[model samples]
Target: MPHSHQNRIQAPQLAAVVVACIALFTDMLVYGILIPLLPLMPAVSRSGPAATGLLFAAYAGMMIIVTPLAGRFVDRRGPRGPLLAALLGLGMACLLFAVGGPYWLLLVSRLLQGAAAGLGWVASLALIAAAIPLPKRGTYLGIAMSMVSLGTLAGPPLAGWLAREYGHAAPFVFATVVLLIDGALRIAFVRPVPPQADDPATALDVLRVKGAWPVVILIAVGSGVTSMIEPILPVQLHEALGLDSVQIGLLFGLLVIVAATLNPLVGAALGRCSPRFLVFCGVLLAMAGLLLLGGGARHAPVIAGVVILGAAIAFLVAPASTLIGVVGARTSPPALGGAYSLYNLAYAAGLV
Candidate 1:
């Protein structure tokens, strides 16, 4: 019995979660790192805002089409194979970005990278849900999202520093190296499992589970509200407070740090509190934070608002993810892939 217990403790589950975390962290890191480097790319520099706007559109466009497909594929197959493939695709995208490109190739790179990101999000969440039991997914998913926030926090600054010190290609080269390591980790940690028996069930089937739509909507709201903040905050802070880049970065930096710290706690909180209660609390906090930012004349309120907003996000994301996993696990034969693919769509819809 003790030996059996040891086997359970040493099961590949946590390794799977670790791989998922690494994949997400790397995906977001490269994504964050690219922000500073893109404008410096020859094609973007020549074309300016129009080209930059196109790249943004291209990423959203690809996510709309690719993320759901990736999720569906994961349902038919399994997370291991798809996760590795997505990492490889992400590496290639980094390579393309690293080498610099004509406008068209950069667009292709954005599209490929977006698709790979979609794949990574789906596969990682599915991987975690697959490896973790129902009661524990909340905490793990929270930890996973924390890594995401951390990636975003680190990406732009790191890219800026690297570019200033080394060259334009340095950021991508660094990202490529990281992806290779993530890929290798995937190979070692994610055991090759044969595909599951084909489920006739579609994504719709997963949604049909009672109360699924509410959680899905929560996901969309959680993702959308958070995303809608990114583009607007810098401009708002600049105009309202006359803050420079460093000040604005500091504000967002605080937000990310707070969110990262709170995410795991919210997940762990699930054992005691309900998802609805947590989300309700998140909504209230979001409204309060927005009010603080919108009306504040001084630094303290703005800073307070950012931190509160970060906490709100932690409350929103962890519960919604845990609920999604719960419902996804309910489907006959358990189509976590389909469930999380729908999650991708909600997330993308929110993002776009």
Candidate 2:
């Protein structure tokens, strides 16, 4: 290929990666921002914690349904339209969250956000696969996952400070502004690559690939174990160790910090090692961490478990998608979108 042609290809791929990272960041940021604000909101507070839990469930539930459909849509229509639509939906959801009327309105906002999440994730991952070469997929996916981890780490503290100093609506407004800028950037620079004609494998065909089912199972089990910890850990700390809210917060923060710090390293490793080996090691580490958590009545053991579990999560998460992408690439007819959709679906189901 000519130098100019190479530049053209690389430019779009780079833009696609950037767009995917930003989209994933925005999705996680909005999600994390809601954690603190929901309990404090007047409409939500009156309904109690169960309602708030339901709100979270609503998002995951929609994601479980929408992701596979979004993947199929991307396969048929390319990612640009669904990506743009998701951004638009996310913007609207943010606007609704900021406005804050009835409790039902909040539910509506969450539902929209879930749809956006589903579309955004499916489109973004599919776009990444389409844009980047197979060997580099893990590295770029790691970068994208790192952005998500950072968002999760940053969003709650930022939301709490904003809500404390400003008002309940302030964080959502901030999110709205950031999302608008992100959407504008997408519109301006992120052009979609056409779906490859060679990738004719349907979702069912993708599922039949030898290694794919095991990868999906691993994703689900890993995600389920990780998700279980997030809600249960603070309670365990408060009751078992008599830690105050601030201490609990710091501990959770440490977990995210460890995971975020290690994400890029794990991602880089995925490029060099067999993903299956990394995943197997990760599962073993996770089991050990869980054992520690179960037995650790004291502080040191608990902290050790937390650190080990965080590392396990990083190992599991960074490689699972890469492995799926790799398998899809090797298929008789590559089914990148379908393979990714199943992975996303499994992860979302695990979260719920």
Range of the 10 consecutive residues with the lowest summed lDDT in candidate 1: 193-202
lDDT of 2 at 31: 79
Check candidate 2 and list the clashing pairs. none
List lDDT for all candidates, in order.
Answer: 0.76, 0.77
What lDDT is reached at residue 10 by model 2?
A: 72
Q: What lDDT does model 2 reach? A: 0.77
Q: Once superposed on the true structure, which residue ranges of model 1 sit more than 4 Å away at CA?
A: 1-15, 35-54, 75-81, 96-106, 126-146, 188-191, 195-202, 232-250, 265-281, 287-302, 329-338
Candidate 2's error at 273, in angstroms?
9.1
Residues 188-218 of candidate 2 have per-residue lDDT tens digits of: 8667577655555655677788888877877
Q: Which runs in model 2 stand beyond 4 Å of their true positions? A: 1-9, 39-50, 99-102, 133-139, 229-251, 264-305
Error of 1 at 131 (Å): 5.5
Please, what's the RMSD in Å of model 2? 4.0
How does each model score on TM-score?
Answer: 0.76, 0.79
* TM-score result, candidate 1: 0.76
**Model 1 agreement with the true structure over 180-234: per-residue lDDT tens digits:** 8998899888875433343335567899898889988888887766655554555
